[model samples]
Target: MNLIGIFGTSGFAREVGDIALAQGYQPLYIARDQTELDAWSFAGTAILESEVEIYREIGFAIGIGENAIRQKVARRFAGQLKFINLIHPSATFGQGQRQIVEARQGMIVCAGVRFTNNIQVGDFGVFNLNATIGHDVIVDDFVNIAPGAHISGNVHIGPRCWIGTGAAINQGQGDTKLHIGTDTVIGSGSVVVKACESHSVYVGIPAKKIK
Candidate 1:
């Protein structure tokens, strides 16, 4: 069994652990501290590599709070770490299915249906349930795409972005490369058509870029 160590013991971490086990990996709970990690390593338990690779593998960072402690720990242990991917049991991926595509060990794909080559989900990104990602789209790391969102084809979402619930990107015609910058927020039920810069909040039709 591939022993998978979780960085945190929070509810989110538990949820991730469940997925890890379902994916045929052995899940071990580890505190988000260097001492605990060292202890676990000393105990001959393999630490899960989830720092740079998770961020680098996926487009964004999941479970990253404002505090820098976790980041520091991850950086310190990245060399000996092993990252893993978490996919819901209900999720499916195959040929000709209209949905998003996450890279190898990339993105947290929740239960949902996706099209063939519709969305390119970056490493450590998240797609909540029941969301539809259209074809030829790019989603960067640390992105949070809420449930029931409809993303059309040829759209590009940057890293650390959040696409809110029931939002529609590239709804209807006017096919273009819709870009959302890093750390951007798309409000609920919003429609985006144009390109967005980093750290912008967008809402309404045509998606005005707000600070």
Candidate 2:
């Protein structure tokens, strides 16, 4: 079986391990030290980051949820190691057939997710449980869509944006696309109907910027 090294021992890492196991890959916990490794009950062997060079055959995945941290780690190991995309088997495509969704490296797609056709997802994007992405949606790198969030068709989400749990982004009409700018945070339960500016926090119905 292929050995997959998961960096970070958080709950999300364990979740990714389960997905890796489902895909017939052996999951190894990668940590800084033995103490950090011991804290998490991982099924496979634990190895420190310094010892990672020894495992030349292993592929890695970033288990950190924060966009900045994930981006840093991804860049650090970019040329040195191969990053794996872990998509759960239960995720359903638009049609009945299993067609390929446009997902890039280090993406973590959870179970019960649904994707429509022509969806483009960038590197290291996280689609939480049951999140739905509609047709022709463009998701940039390091974007995290929380559980139960619904992103409509022709939506362009910029890099490092966080869509909180249950947030809904309205689709664009005709040739227009609703754009969520870079580094913006959409609060949980917010309903975004228009374009959002970069580096702002949007909340409430119709999604007004608060910060």
Candidate 3:
């Protein structure tokens, strides 16, 4: 059986291992240091990162949930290891028999996530549990959609954005796309009805810039 190297030693790392198990591949949990190596929850599955040996066709994934850290890890390992997309079994792509138009590698699509048609997803992104994406959405690299977040149609999300838990982004009307600039943060339970600025934090009912 092929082994997938999962970087990180947290509970989420083990959750990613669950995806590997569901896909019938062995999950090799790589620890950053001796402390994590000793504290890893899964017995016989953990190994020090320094002890990693690259095998032909071996795949790697970042099990961490943060967008910035994920991007950092992906960059550090780029061109060195084969990146993989881990889609959970219960996730659905597209609605009404439609499908995602395009997707890239190192994407972690968790259980119950849904993607509507004509969505273009970039590399090394995470779609957390029960998150939904509507049609004509363009998501950039290293974006993280937290659990239960809902993204409506005609939305263009820029790179390294964090869409917090249960946030809802409203759909743009006919030919108008709500643009979320790069490095933005949409706070938890917030409703986004307008375009968001880059490197800012938005929160509240009609998301106002808090930072």
Q: Among these predicted structures, which one has the highest TM-score?
A: 3
Q: What would the per-residue lDDT of candidate 3 be over residues 17-47, giving only the tens digit for each residue?
A: 8887888789999898999888876644888
- Tell me model 1's lDDT, rounded to 2 decimals: 0.62
lDDT of 1 by residue, 9-57 (tens): 5555555566666777666665555664565432223333443343232
Indicate the worst ten consecutive residues by lDDT in candidate 2. Answer: 95-104
**Candidate 1, residue 156: lDDT:** 86
- Best first by lDDT, ranked: 2, 3, 1
Superposed model 1: Cα runs more than 4 Å off: 33-77, 94-103, 113-115, 171-175
Residue runs of model 2 more than 4 Å from their true location after superposition: 33-35, 95-103
Q: Which ten residues in a row are the worst by lDDT in model 3? A: 94-103
Model 1 misses residue 168 by how many Å? Answer: 1.9
Best by lDDT: 2
RMSD of 2: 2.0
Name the candidate, 1 or 3, with the larger lDDT value.
3
| 205: Cα error in model 2, Å | 1.5
